[model samples]
Target: MATASTIFSDCSSSTTARLVPLSRIRNGILQFRQSVSVGWKPKNPSLNFISTHGRSSSSIVTVAMATEPSATVIDGKSVAKKIRDEIRSEISRMKDATGIVPGLAVILVGDRKDSATYVRNKKRACEAVGITSYEVHLPENSTEEEVLNSISGFNDDPSVHGILVQLPLPPHMNEETILNEVSIKKDVDGFHPLNIGRLAMRGREPLFVPCTPKGCIELLHRYGIEIKGKRAVVIGRSNIVGMPAALLLQREDATITIVHSRTKHPEEITSQADIIISAVGQPNMVRGSWIKPGAVIIDVGINPIEDAQSPRGYRLVGDVCYEEACKVASAITPVPGGVGPMTIAMLLSNTLVSAKRAHNFE
Candidate 1:
């Protein structure tokens, strides 16, 4: 007989487990329970699942081998903090050595509160890392020519190392046209078609990667999660997060699947992925059942759902159900603290990189 190990040769070796079933004696007397070893080694093991099928009298209990504990909490907040510290230290060294202070310019065309908040947070992050931040806020009714002119001015500014046009520009403005006007050299937001095109090609590098996607990949690398040969699924196909995320994963040598609104049986497809990045805006769209045990989850959704119990009348949740995922995933990121902080961190990082490249500073 082919042993389970031989049959599943591709599976990573961990502790092994044995299932024990209880049987009733004819006289209704309790029989001595036999010991069964559940998988990872006897001391530290892998994931063990339980299922029961028999008459009502039968009882099945899962006894996991005394293995390693539950999955790790991939804390993006702390990770981002560490990255910011490093960036600040490097910026300090560069300023002392060469008197170059990296500068980022943010162009906001409208007055959406959410957009304003994001821009403010970005500015704060830049300041925290010793990067000078320049801002240009145009009226919602500003002309496309005005927007383009503003970008051209930033492009001519030698001190500006990076230029980011806040997204969701006014309805009157052409997003693609305006985005392309920003100099490719200063395209720190990484939305330029040229940059995205380069990102998709082998042996090619982009001037910058989309911040959110870059942040997602950064989280995986920092956590020491191997991506070279893993199966990865990215939920959502938005340009900002999903589409680029899949491309980035491919660059890392991970097999990629994208589950979007048109994807049928998304659960089945997602369950097969060793790494799942849920960027879909739907709240709790990816359930526990959709996850395979021991898979790593990086949730990018930040949706506000009604929660009358709280003073704000709502709470933020990720596309993946956190409570349910905690039971099955090997590691998972929380909603607010996970991908959010990393986005800004990557923005700062890209700015620093842009400055280094521009000044020919190693």
Candidate 2:
């Protein structure tokens, strides 16, 4: 009886044998015997005998390793860094050629800490990319007309290429009114109803895609992940992330299924997906068993959970259970370091794209 290690070592030493190591040889033999046991001939002998030890196979296995690649950690931080650098170069070139600097105007109302933080980050990203940042801060009791007027000013300003109204406006102010007032061309956040509607419809191109969802799709593209003809499940139906995500996936020719709070047996449906984008705010809503083997997971949730051990007394969490999902999933995005940075990057990208289109830089 050839021990498994001995067989693998011997196979590794062979040149002409096209040695199939025991790890794969066991699977191949089992598949062959199973076919024979069912009164069927193994129709794919070449596939069965081929050694799965090539560079591509090794690269994939290396990425999928439990402790080595850390369960296919999607490095959104690094990806965002690259994108920012590209944007910086583009801005420098645009300035040299056309002598115009793209400008982004952000309107922040009220004192919501989260919204403030997001606005600050957006400004910092603009500064890094050589884009001018115009920020308008209003009190919590600011009138709806005041917010709308700010948007109106940015709309007429030829230098301003992008306008983003920080979300969660005051209770008295109308959110839709403020967002709709932004000119479609300057609506970098893509919250305007017209952009959202265009994004949802087929055969139409949206002037801008919402930042977070666009970031997720950019991640998939950067990684060379296949999406066409694949089954993708987007958990959540919010207009911001989930709905736009599903629309984008559909645009890529993926068969998309949108799951919401009312959805029953969500896991049963999710288990069939080749790709899962969970944006539901519930922490750990998705488990290991809910994911298909070799499935790609994009976790868009950023719920804050209480933790006494942390300095902030709260920590960010995603909808999927990171620990368990790592075991079953082929690739996954971590909570804080993953989708968060990409959102800002995509916003900058959309701003630059808007500026180029406005100036006909292309």
Q: Who wins the lDDT comparison?
A: 1
| TM-score quality measure for candidate 2 | 0.81
Full-model lDDT for every candidate: 0.75, 0.74
What does candidate 2's lDDT look like per residue over 256-356, in tens digits? 99977667667777889999998765555576657777788998876555445569765655666665566567788877677878988989999999999
Candidate 2, 33: how far from true, in Å?
A: 52
Compute the lDDT of residue 222 as modeled in candidate 1: 92
Residue 168, candidate 1: alpha-carbon lDDT? 75
Compared to the true structure, candidate 1 yields what TM-score?
A: 0.81
Q: For all the candidates, what are their Cα RMSDs to the real structure?
A: 14.6, 14.4
Indicate the residue-level lDDT of 163 in model 2. 94
**Candidate 1 wrong stretches, greater than 4 Å:** 1-69
lDDT (tens digit, per residue) of candidate 1 on 1-362: 11001111011111111111221121101111331121122111222232211112112221221232345677889999999999999999889889999999999987887679888999999999999999999999999999999999999998999999987787878889999999999998888989999998999999999888899999999999999999999887777788899999999999999877667667778779999998765555666667788899998876565455559765666666664465578888877788888988999999999999999988
